[model samples]
Target: MSDHPFDVLAARALRVGAYLVRADDQGRLYDGIGLKPEHWRRAQTLLADAPEPWQKLLTSDPGDDRIILPNGGHILRLSSNRRGRHEHTILAVIEPCVCSKPLGQVLSESTEADSGCTNVTTPGQCNGCAAACLSDPITVECLLRCWYEDLFKLGRQESELTKLSQQLAETYEELNLLYRLGQELTVSGDPRCFVQSLCQDLLEVMSFRWVAVKLFDLPELSEQLAGMFVCEGTTQKTINEAEQAVEALAQMPQVHKPAVVLDIASQWGHLLPALGNSLLAYPLYKGETMYGLIVAIDKDPEAGDISSVDLKLVGSTASQLRIFLDNVTLYDQMHLMFLGTLEALTAAVDAKDRYTCGHSQRVALLSRQLAEALGLPPDRVERIHIAGLMHDVGKIGVPESVLCKAGKLTKEEYEIIKGHPEIGANIVKDIPHFDDIIPGVLYHHERYDGKGYPHGLAGEDIPMMGRLLALADSFDAMSSTRTYRAALPRERVLEEIQACAGSQFDPDLTPHFLSLDFSEYDGQVANHKAGDPGAQGVAA
Candidate 1:
């Protein structure tokens, strides 16, 4: 019994006093209930003096086998653990002794002496003493009954162990689900993509019929993804019904208890999805911020109602999900704040020149439009938009007199003007996430034929942002009023842009810029004239 692995052999040890023992090494014992030193010494002696049939069981493969030994007035049971191993044997006894002499010893003494059996009405049948009942044939009806009772008790214990094993398995799978969700979180920061994947996985782990997760405050994602909808095993009507109920649920004081609407005739039955079972709706939130809600429909009937473990699993992940999205919201706010400050700085620069009051605003809008028209990704398009807004940020370094000059600039003034792109690039070069925007700010004035500006590399050597911004800047510059020239007509600007396709503009990217809608531009320009800031910054 050195290993003592009978923790789940819980019945016998709890009921009487089950002690672990090795069948072969009867002297050694383990996992024993309370027994004095004297009792332990007597226990070892009792096993050594056991009857032939009981002794044979010590070495035999009798799984769940039982043997009853007679003590003074009590009986002790030795039961096998059924594992066929020597160390897993169990000794169960309430109190092994009740009198000075054991029953087996008393019977042996009586069997040896005949004169004491004078009241024996029949052979081997004194009928008065307990020893007479086992006169010769030795039919112990009570011992047989004890054996059956032990067998039944052991069977019941096995059932309890099975239930415990199942609970452990459920816990293991829940941990696995958490691990996978953590992996998903590291790879994709998008909340919608995260929740969509979570719904699919939740169904598999919780054994639920369907799952619906919805976003509330994060509007950076699309409406289709943000709105509540069952991700699996449901229809649009059911999703719409859930969406309608969100306000009512949100208004009500929340209870952690699940609302089980299993009855088809229940009031919510018409709205809940999955005809098979129950519905569980849990709000995913942190303090006052309601990030989202997860609605689990029709939990498997066989799995029964939700347990604390189930709630904890969902709640733990929900808490993490909210944190991820909240961080993104904060990130977006910081980004917007930074962009706002940049707008203020450029508005001050434009303030130095009366004619170019809204020049940066129009260029920013058109550049963004052109990036989209050229099918650049969302992140790239955003960078280009910021680039356009700060395209002429270098003008802040130019003398106010030179910027507002009403005639063509002298050579020295033109040279001073040309240095603005380098000044603008240097201004923002060290700002985080502005690396790509630098080239656009520095090279917007560069031409396609390598004949333009500082470090004028030809063709595709120009950064993509620089290429796109060049086209947009030229378009806006030709159309907008400048200090030296009246705003050119729209058709003439188009003709001039086409004439300089390869020499001044990227021929491959030029067509995409030409096709963009200018209605927004027209409106912004009109707003500029009307003295409404619009996309334009504050007036000089």
Candidate 2:
């Protein structure tokens, strides 16, 4: 597990039993290849009892220079331990190291140790091998150089390992940053908030001195993003100054790809007052259209100058912003496309009853307001608004004679009027993506008291869309002029709605419906009247 190739070579080249010992405490032993525990303790005592010159050999640091000890012992320096004390790796002569027999056999046969052996030298006659194997230092100098060479290799390995560790850490940080960016990409709607968040996050991970994004020419983004500049991190510059830096980036004709500008004062001196010492910028563009720019100016001094990794990150983030803008553009186009078709169909229905010139548009707008007031989710509220535009499509099937009689309807003509809800429902059911609104169209005429129309679905049995649409439909119908009756005043309409709450409409939704601002509705009515001179008194 440890890196000690030099330790092995130092022992083999010297042909001595190597043991690691603390230079401060010469009596202690660590790694002794073939030496017994008692052999080490005996050898330590012998060195202690020997002449002061022998004791000095164990106490002093060998430090690349080889040291000789009693019984042909050799010592070399290894790096210091974590405790700051030098570990002297010694290759020493001992009883067990002189022969091939096990270390225990040699220690038991020793006769001049502990009691009578007081001097440093302790050699013994082996039963199977020679008494001593002292190393030839001068002869093995080249191999000893290999020991130093091996140590050099270890140093290089440690340096490389340290470098690799830092790279792996940086890679992990980049992955985490990308993961968070992915979350924002999928869920966020506000471009201003998204860009501001991106700047703050990049500042923390990339250690930039200042981070900022500038947006322009993106009509799909909400108007809130007009003249928007999002930034994070501290610099002497104000937001206007930051915007100037971004403007410089945008205006730079050569910056089509992600690139860095080093020595900002020298290379981009024009922007020096607004920027840091260096800059990394990535332009957000789609095809030939440029949308925005993301810039990071001057990295943290501790983080070093902006590197290639920083440039790549800025490029990737810019691409994401471009994607968000493209998505918004596509979605807006599809939304307008969807409304275009329904607008044409509603126009045909309006032509059959000239008095209700913009009745469908008004009902749709009013229903949208009521849906918002009732706290419906956006998707449902939007569907309700579109559904309101086609709610009276069945009126296209009724005879114009019955619709605009301008007189009391006979029994047969009135029944024909009552069948319009079913006709509207059938017509909408065949239209793609209009299935969700059929319940609303069919049951809009059904009353709360089980007395008023085709299905007579009373109270809670009615679908929620139907229940909601009922209030908007009746409110517009009663408030607007019809061939049979004049338009009611606001106060009279409000009182009639309040009185009919329990039987004609859902009592729960009546309050929220009554709370709507009719100013827009009044404006819509006035606009329709201006467009069609007789629209005010026609049947809606």
Candidate 3:
């Protein structure tokens, strides 16, 4: 028999309560049964006891050989040629006696076979013996084995697919959480508020007893910590413990080093008893400047270990916070620079008319105060202040002769002065970050009743900032001495403003401007004159 035919017979023998063993040329035995520990021992003992028959099978003729053991178990050795070599042998062990019936009938009755056995032979025969008598035992065994293998393989595939689905779901949720954090961080302008918001949003996705952010005054190792922002889910005691732990770590020599995760108890020894042992401290840095540190304390036990995904999420969030901090710092520096530039530009315009040396500055101060009294937000008030200072910027293009003229001029000269608002607007329009101040600079001369210059933008049609600037500009011009006239009395200036509310000034803002006390500014006007050589004899 060939080795393939012998293998088929051996499998059938296994179905019929028999086990198969193959011995290689090296005398090593391979159990064809499931090879439990007991099965392997039995196979080894059986071969050891029947040494004569085993030796005869290997050295003598290639034929069937049988050995009857002391326990009445029979071992049949069948010789087979594998790959044209007759060196392989198959041993089948059957207890007591071999089944005379076919193996298929034995398996169908004894085991759950895929197909039913229809042979109606030998009444009163045992189920094993009856199934063994089936007509095509080899074909039946093959079909049953194939079905079992396929079902087992399918079960394993389904298990793997379920794991992949769960992994995909977790990844999607992490991405969504990070996206929400980005939105919250970007919208807030205050650093402390951003840190507090960061802690609150992080709680939604990650489990922690407390979270805190501590920022340094300077990005230097020796600088003192400036502020600390925190959010807590536990008691204040726990928050304090976490803070202490972070402070101790920051004071260490490795404070300027990379991020570290440490066991709170081991690292600080009862400093944070309320917190879990796992604490994550990530440094917030932009280049070499270490801005702050983000600390998450006492990870939830239910969340298991901190996974790689958790680390990646925290690291990315820290990067975003660092970016926002850098932007805010840069914006503040640029804001100071912008203010200085505006001051220099306005001084040049003031110099052209010595009588109005401090006129623009006073107008800016009053416009800012009036805007605040009107309940405008802080940012809007600031824009109005800048606009008031630059409202006369267009006069830079007018002849200094015309601007400093001592007496009323011809209609031609007045027209030349009226065009300054447009000229001023054009000059500042191209300067970067000046969009908010453009309208006021261009339309501060516009009248409330459609009678003023450049554009006859009337009433509410005028930009709100422009309307506010007009009131400030006109009041400063009348209250202070100009080349054409002496300074008007405070009451007289107030009467002029009150009478022109509807026609010259915004009706809604006129009363608000009139409500302000001019006496408080008297010292400020005197101080400006004291500093100006051109205002030596000007009446205040």
Candidate 4:
């Protein structure tokens, strides 16, 4: 038979064909097949004219025609027509290759070719039927083509799979970084640190070139947008470009509310060619109030020119970051409003009588110091500070006659004085974010040891902040000149605080209250106490 393509090509493809026809399919056989050699077209074309049933011979059932291969104990099958018979009479029998497998696999010994009968085709007899198949020329050509096509496809698939795996690894890394940034933003309380950390994460993980954040400053009744934070990549020069674009939009006589440059490439709307000419901005808003804008900048000018994938990522990430910014701004603003209302209430209380100006401010300072001394977390300390400032809020409801009385109050008047804590709690009860502080304000007068007034909460039952504030409120009251008494000396005030520990104050926090350094605030206290008569209540 003509030589197979396996005989002519590189060793790898030839080894693959050799392995596929092994006697028992053992080790080294498959490796031998993978190392098969390739043959040229000139060689393959000569074999294509041969007349073996090459397709059936290579892949058909072994039972039909079996040739026990020489020396090696493998059964190979080939079926062909018998020669010199009636024109085309077929004698189906297994036949082995006549040529030595020096170009294929090694054999132990030369074997006789299988024509039809076993006796005539013994190991010692004649040439194999491959001689007959080779002389015909059609069989060898078809088999060579089949093997080559399969190997090419397998190599291509392996290459593609490797690329897909690499891409998946990169995507996982990006998601992990985002998750970590989310955790940091959730735990962090400071807005500036939170935003700065977020920006750094976007630049490093998401590959954003430039990012900027702005906040609304209410100069009048209307909010004026101001850029509070901006971060740009080292490579990118378009810093604050988005802000300039928004500012330009605001200046146009045609648009009223702030205009967003959603797609910058378009000609009709706001355009700034300098700002990388590409923009994405999400409004930081809470209800009707516009807090600010978050802008993500890229250099691509045409919409089609920018990556749709990257743009989607920027939009989603910006939305999440915007929520965080809006939340923090709302929290800070509400805190300010709480302080403002507290001031108004304190002023109303002072308006009832001139004797206690800046009373709440003093209480607030002392309460904060005491809260710190107790090693409270900053969040709790903040709540305590607000509670201290607004503790006297209920006093706003007290009558002027009772507040300014110079002598000891009647039993009826003391009852009216005792109602302020409840009144203060009631006033701020409806305000969100003030609920935690309400207990401290309403219950500051309560005794830690169950001996004080109002609910007379005992021991740990009194809130730590309320207990701390109780000491501050009591000490400040004694230290200040009231309608009934002259101001007490610092030494006497410290002694009184020590005496009331565990009884009127949380014993654990009393030492901190006594240790407070009064020097820094002494002048401010004296100045506020020396209220200008002209400074009446603030306008509603």
Best by lDDT: 2
Instruction: Score every model by TM-score.
Output: 0.66, 0.63, 0.62, 0.52
Error of 2 at 33 (Å): 22
Computed on alpha carbons, the lDDT of every model, listed in order, comes to: 0.62, 0.68, 0.67, 0.55
lDDT string, candidate 3, 46-131, tens digits: 66676365645544453445666665555665444344434565565544333456544465554432232222222212254443
Residue 295 accuracy (lDDT) in model 1: 66
Q: Tell me the alpha-carbon RMSD of every candidate.
A: 12.9, 9.9, 10.3, 14.3
**Residues 154-195, model 1: lDDT tens digits:** 767877999899788877877788788777873224556777
- The per-candidate count of clashes, in order, stands at 0, 1, 9, 31
Worst 10 residues of 1 by lDDT: 116-125
Which structure is stronger by TM-score: 3 or 4? 3
lDDT of 2 by residue, 440-533 (tens): 7888888888887888789999887787778888877877777778878778878888999989889998999889998888788778888788
Highest TM-score model number: 1
Q: Which stretches of candidate 4 lie over 4 Å from their true place?
A: 1-150, 187-334, 448-451, 457-461, 499-503, 523-540
Candidate number with the higher lDDT (1 or 2): 2
Model 4 / residue 271 / CA error / Å: 38
lDDT of 4 at 384: 84
- The regions of model 1 sitting more than 4 angstroms off are 1-175, 186-189, 217-260, 271-277, 286-291, 300-306, 530-540
Better of 1 and 4 by TM-score: 1
